[model samples]
Target: MKLTTKGRYAVTAMLDLALHHKGEPVSLAEISERQDISLSYLEQLFAKLRKAGLVVSMRGPGGGYQLCSDPKEIAIADIIAAVDEHVDATRCGGLGDCQDNRRCLTHDLWTDLSNQIRVFLSGITLADMTERADVRQTAARQVKRLEMVADSAR
Candidate 1:
């Protein structure tokens, strides 16, 4: 699959938001620190996400971003799509022009794979990912590490 950093980071940042958005907006700076993603990149991704109606931004003190709906209602596929990322496994991007404007021999296989990937991602929601024990563990670790860094800096 051709899932680039854009798609991966969008999902990661959205998951971070889902995990920490407890009736309050989560800042992109916090997400960037936790996920090791760039703040500027997140800004670009979030602009698209907001436009897609997946998230809403708040302004003023304690301002940041929040999910538009429940995490369970937001599919991973939707997040990826919101960032203009495609889950295509085909070289031709499912356009059936893999070989000189003609369908390649393995075009069908790749197209099917792409469809399967899309379906798999669509079936998974941010809530589903948040429910995973390993995810929680990793998030806790990230928080602890940040705390340690802060303590050292103080």
Candidate 2:
């Protein structure tokens, strides 16, 4: 199933925090700038994440927000569920009673796919995303440096 912008932004926001983590809180504006997310939206999402215990907020000059636990310990599902109200992929409305709803021929398929999606998302963590992002950043930097050297040589 396709993920919405809310889910996508939540992941990016968490990754921003993971990248700038220095054993202290990071301001929402900092993460907003880094992720290119609106400060107001970040503030809204952060409130939900805080309530979910995925993040903690501080209030002061040096206060902002921080992950409640290590990135590795925080699953992608946690972030998505925190920011987005629902994560069900194949449900008609909610996850209550879809088995007995007549005319639902693909009900089993939807249910199975939902389970797979949950497993896949829960298997990944914020730390995994951060590590991959770091690798991509380093590779891009190297490519840029190589291109600059080639241009200078030419």
Candidate 3:
């Protein structure tokens, strides 16, 4: 399946929020900047996420978005679905349209693969990622790079 930037970025942005938010709202701008994602794109994703009850938005100063539940409660598949991302390995989007007016011989194979991917993602949580040392190290490297850039620009 082709996992587009929409799905990848949504996960990246959510992970950033989960890592940075410490009982305070984390602004979309901060997530966009840190994750190197477009602000407008995040806006659209967050809109869907808000509607899906995956996130809660705050207003006024020091306001932004927060996870509606604990990180462990949020599944990767849920985030992907909230953003309307489809994980279909088949060319027909699980519709068996790979062949002209007929189903391809391997239609079921790809369909099963997609379902397995969904299950794999469902089993993963944001909290699970937060516990990964590699994820933390990558984020830390980005933070250090940003700090250096800021210092150099000063």
For every model shown, what is its TM-score relative to the native structure? Answer: 0.98, 0.79, 0.95
lDDT of 3: 0.93
Query: Mind sharing the TM-score for model 1?
Result: 0.98
Superposed model 2: Cα runs more than 4 Å off: 94-103, 133-154
lDDT of 3 by residue, 10-113 (tens): 89999998998899999998888788999999999999999999999999999999999999999999999999999989988887778995789999999999
Comparison by TM-score, 1 against 3, better one: 1
C-alpha lDDT values of all predictions: 0.95, 0.80, 0.93
Residue 149, candidate 3: C-alpha displacement in angstroms: 2.3
The clash tally of candidate 2 reads 0
* lDDT tens digits by residue: candidate 2, 1-154: 5688888898888877887778999999877755668999999999999999999998989999999999999998888888864556565744545557653667667767777887888999978877796745954565467668779999
Off by over 4 Å in 3: none
Q: Sorted by TM-score, highest first, which candidate order results?
A: 1, 3, 2
**Runs in model 1 lying further than 4 Å from the true structure:** none
Q: 113-134, model 1: which lDDT tens digit per residue?
A: 9889999999999999999999
For each of the candidates, give the backbone clash count: 0, 0, 0
Ten-residue segment with the worst summed lDDT in candidate 2?
A: 94-103
